[model samples]
Target: MKFAPSWDPTTAIAQQRRDAMLVRLRELRALEQRAVDRSAEARPVFDKRGQLLPRERVGLLLDPGEPFLPLCTLAGYQQDTREAASSIPGGGMVAGIGFVRGTRCMVVASDSGIDAGAIQPMGLEKILRLQEIALENRLPFVHLVESAGANLMRYRVEGFVQGGALFRNLARLSAAGIPVITVQHGSGTAGGAYMPGLSDIVIMVRGRSRAFLAGPPLLKAATGEVATEEELGGAEMHTAVSGLGEYLAEDDRHALGIAREVVASLGWQQERAKLESDPDKDVLLTLMPANLREPVDLREVMVRLVDGGELLEFKPAYGAATVCAQGRIAGHAVGFIGNNGPIDVAGANKATHFIQWMCQLGHAIVYLQNTTGYIVGRDSEQAGMIKHGSKMIQAVTNATVPQLTIQCGASFGAGNYGMCGRAYAPRFLFSWPSARTAVMGGEQAARTMQIVNEAALARKGQRPDPVQAKLQFDQIVEVFESQADAFHTSGLLLDDGVIDPRQTRAVLAFCLDTIAEAQTRQLRPLQFGVARM
Candidate 1:
């Protein structure tokens, strides 16, 4: 009670400071509310087809519980202007370092909220910065482009210097050893398409997206030829005809999911070995029919050979002749190739494209041989089968990735070699005991021998007996036993060995493990270049 008589001036100052802080907190809350209101106003622009914003796309691609490091957040010059500040990021692009499926990657997503996601001078700088980071860290790069090409206003403002710089950066990224993936979600026209073209893999969504060197309006005005948007640049047209994209996903979500999966498959620096449990032996025996003419589904054998729930088949409906898929055996990624016997020209083209893409992506290829030969006749020739077939062969032969050949049945003629025949130089060449490998089958062999027998009988002035011809055929079959025995090829070490059908998975797993250990010591040349779409 006696101390209350002296009041310090410092106590009064402390009370004033507390009151100031309370006032500031209230003002800050009001500011936050205003920002929320502005965002709500902008939501309709992004909701047009329910598309995600650039930031949201980045969030979806990254692994859960991981944070991203935004690259050059203030790179947009337009954002510095009052008119664009409310919509665009500092730059037209938003780039950062992020993780996908626990693997580090560099991501660059365009802001559709700003000028329809156009590329500006600052946007190009943002992309270059991210590319440089990717090169430095040896990480994969992903591009989510939904743009209207270069920003004319920015280019005019910069006096044409911006264009050269952006193209140069694109070229540099294309040459970088790290994998680059690009997805086209909206209107990717003219220069917009170039960005995705510079990437190693391009994915596009159906209906909701379009990509072209020029917009339809521009084309009609320039060439005096009118075409609809779909006719000019639909997913099907680009994927099948232009060959711009590696995959055509069903929608935006599917495209992003595929992008994540593709990146995960390619993140490793070295080939990985697969470990798989033994599949049922009887499954193989019963999978294919004994009748040579009967059509059997190739997917049955592919599913059996690869680990369950790990197969990702590419262009399933488009490529009926070849089956290309990525699968895991014991948590290791492996590429699988199987023949969809007797397919049309379209199937051949699709299969070739898949093989080429797989080789470029650097996956260990496993060939499941079961094809007669390339499609023949006038129709096939007209369809450019020769050109497409040659492309497939070149891709296979030039592939530096480890290859394993498993001949299930009917590896006849050139088709056998094309599908990892012993001549193509595979790490291991194996055959099932029942596999019939020859220039032709037994029936064809008999016909040729019968002709020879008849010619001899005619020369000797004796009637050629059907029974005698049969005896001669039997004798020839006995003599050719050395060529037919699976052990002979393995014993000579020309082929690896004859593996039991059930033991295929186990054997492959062991081989993959063995090869992976050896491959880790060497650095494979990263020579793939991004194709201009």
Candidate 2:
């Protein structure tokens, strides 16, 4: 009698429905598995430290709850069935509009899964379109590049060629004054390096990335010397020697984080208002040592000068001689450049690039002077110090943005000019009583005067008189005094007077507010287009 209950039609129907549902579920699971397998096959490369994929890196850079508007979803150009196989969304390069730190940004990430994220015709188109969008919308552009090289397969298929188009597009983006950042995640070789090189800021992940105009094989064939990828071009080599990239990140995630912070420091175009913050109380004077001979850490001063401990230092490892950063003063973004007093040619070039990039972003510039001069000797010349120094000066002089100069210590010769001296047309030039502005330091001056005194005594056929020598020395000291006093006494340098070291932050805040209030000119409108390549 109990077994008879299971014979109902309703029970039989329920069993059938369950069977059908299980079959459909199995089919969906199988489809999902196939998709995952395909995706893995496409992306063979993984982050050495985090093992994160390019898509995952993009996700990390974007703000939560914000969706991306994809670019070049249909970049593959094969008309026939077989060619369409390689045609995927994003055309091997994933590009789109996304939010980073609540600010709209145009982003392009090369997907290593597809053709090793090579530069295909379609992919180039996508990049150009994204660049256009960034310029038109006044949004910051972030590039995540990981490519083998230009795709030769596209040329075989149909209409495809490569030339100066990419460079031209980069130039346009630069001229348009949009902040462009590039991240070299993995194997940025050949033409791959150029894109990142042209960007305002280049970030590389240690071990997981390498950037060079040529790969090992090509370099070996050309130079007849075998080398490893790191030996030829790695994070340490670029950041410390070439200064091509601004920062060396521990991983892809760290690189994205750095990019986000940098963008936030630049602020948004719509806001236009300068970033402002409270002055660090009494911290500036305490940062420097009492003895002038003892070297002081410039970073300590930077930490005290900026707001929220927010200082976007550029080429930090490259130029130990000068320090450059973007910081907020009274709610306004300002570029800060100071003497590191122990940097190389690479560091100087980095400083130049940082200033140029900041000017392009429309931020005000501040120069904190304390430098000996350009690195001297044969090794420096070999490193192209003259060329790089000239470039740095060019960037400083040509910058259209407002500039402020603060002579923290000794500012000698060309170093003073590079630090935005009066000749550079700075909006305001302030100095502390401890400031020394001259063509050279006192020791160099003493030597030069001694040499002149010796020549004069030799001509007169007598040793230089001690009394006269003392007077001459006193005169030289007075000359130095006059030059040093210009920042305090002359109205040309400051409207009020020399500020105390403790008031550096407050002075900057006041200057930023004044500039923002006085600047009523509208920004020039930018035109948009695909990069020529």
Candidate 3:
């Protein structure tokens, strides 16, 4: 495809904005990292208890020197603004997909280091999505589970209802022949008992792992029974008597080692060819924009990603903002949908057709999101924006082939959903540090609100107060801008992770390879999940 450069990256305005974007990116990263470090506040307690930090457990569980994609690192962000300075993130859990002994698996751990690994509503959302990914991708499920069950004080009935899905998914994984391996680090009780109960292989840390339907106090309250921790459901009792745990280790390190060994023993078939590195590194470096707010020719971005930077543009003249192309990343054939601006009538229709065609061809589609939202105003509605956008949304919702999304820039309003944001369940959705997402841009949203307020006052036959309106608008604008930032949205686990732009190609290649392997592998399904023995 012939390429004419759009925005010049070397321009004074672009360079200045690029530097500012980098600064914001760094700020966001630091903020998220600060939350992670907050878990260290309990590090001394963990050490005293002879346990590793949650992330340290994850590190030891995964194979060394391999990539681990951390999903939903931020959960419960800003939910407690009263403690904004020390608000806990990560939903009291740490989870991601990583390789364990050559097997790509979903590894999740209760971050009991912080707040006893209590279940937060947002953490529940994260785990539910994690389960969907594992099931869809055929990844083996590995959980380092030891949760505080639920916090009744901050609990919602909705969270309680939804939390059942995590348990249901464990059974589903086992029945689907996707092995469920878990290490009960500590306090797997009450609602948490089912974690080990459903796993194909269970590893327990002796003297620490406590898997019980009820603790002693609860048992006494319910049945007037008195029991010690060991009598109730300790690791030794479960492994030796209850037949719940398959392996028992002396300590946290030992348990993780055993879990790794279990993964190594599973002879999962791998048919994926290694992704060959592209020679277009220099081209990708030169073409991709550093400043996300600056309009970018997505063609340049696409060219830098595809194999040898070659692609066949699909209907280039129609829906210019919604770019559709067929190309290969690391020799894997895929379609790409990206945006340079907003999705309009033409853009939505283009996406629908492109998605369907790719589905027919059994090709994966990678979405590079960069749009304010669907077009609005009189002309857009006249052009059937809603109908076409609905059709596009439907196609994205049901496309049979695996979908991946990258939030490279603006992902706002329905545009986020249409572009396969986290809510759309892309096989793997990641974001660049440059990405920003919201219902709408700050100024646009503020103006819309301001207009609505003026109209309301007019309907009441009251004179509109311009000064009061401006104040309200400005406050809303500030709030929107603060939360709409890429880092901010990402800190709430809006995407998988805020990734480096330079690593885009490699990340996409790895994900593509992972999905391809999953598609090729066969499973041995059973009517029921594997029973503990």
Q: Which residue runs of candidate 2 sit more than 4 Å off their true CA positions? A: 1-38, 42-49, 77-87, 153-163, 269-533
Cα lDDT, all candidates: 0.64, 0.65, 0.83
Q: How far out, in Å, is residue 70 in model 3?
A: 1.3
CA RMSD (A), model 2: 29.9
- In order of appearance, the predictions have TM-scores of 0.45, 0.44, 0.91
Off by over 4 Å in 3: 2-11, 82-84, 269-293
Model 3, total clashes: 0
Candidate 3 structure quality by residue, lDDT tens digits, 345-401: 998999999999999999999999988889988999998999999999999999999
Report the error of model 2 at residue 214, Å.
Answer: 1.5
What does candidate 1's lDDT look like per residue over 1-533, in tens digits? 00011212245443443344334335333433332343345567778777776667777888886545444443442333434224333356656666787565778877766667777655665565556545544567788888877766555745255565555565665565556788888888876667666777889888756888877889988998888888888877778888877899887778889998997786453333325345343355454433444555556666666666446777776765677777765555788888768535665666567667766877778888777767778988898877877767776787767788887666776676667787787766677554546666555566778887788888999878778778888776654543443333332333444545656776666556545544443323345555555
- Report the Cα lDDT for residue 461, model 1: 96
Tens-digit per-residue lDDT, 193-251, candidate 2: 77777777888888877888878888888998788888778987888888887899998
**How well does candidate 2 match the true structure in TM-score terms?**
0.44
Query: What residue pairs are clashing in model 3?
Result: none
lDDT of 1 at 301: 65
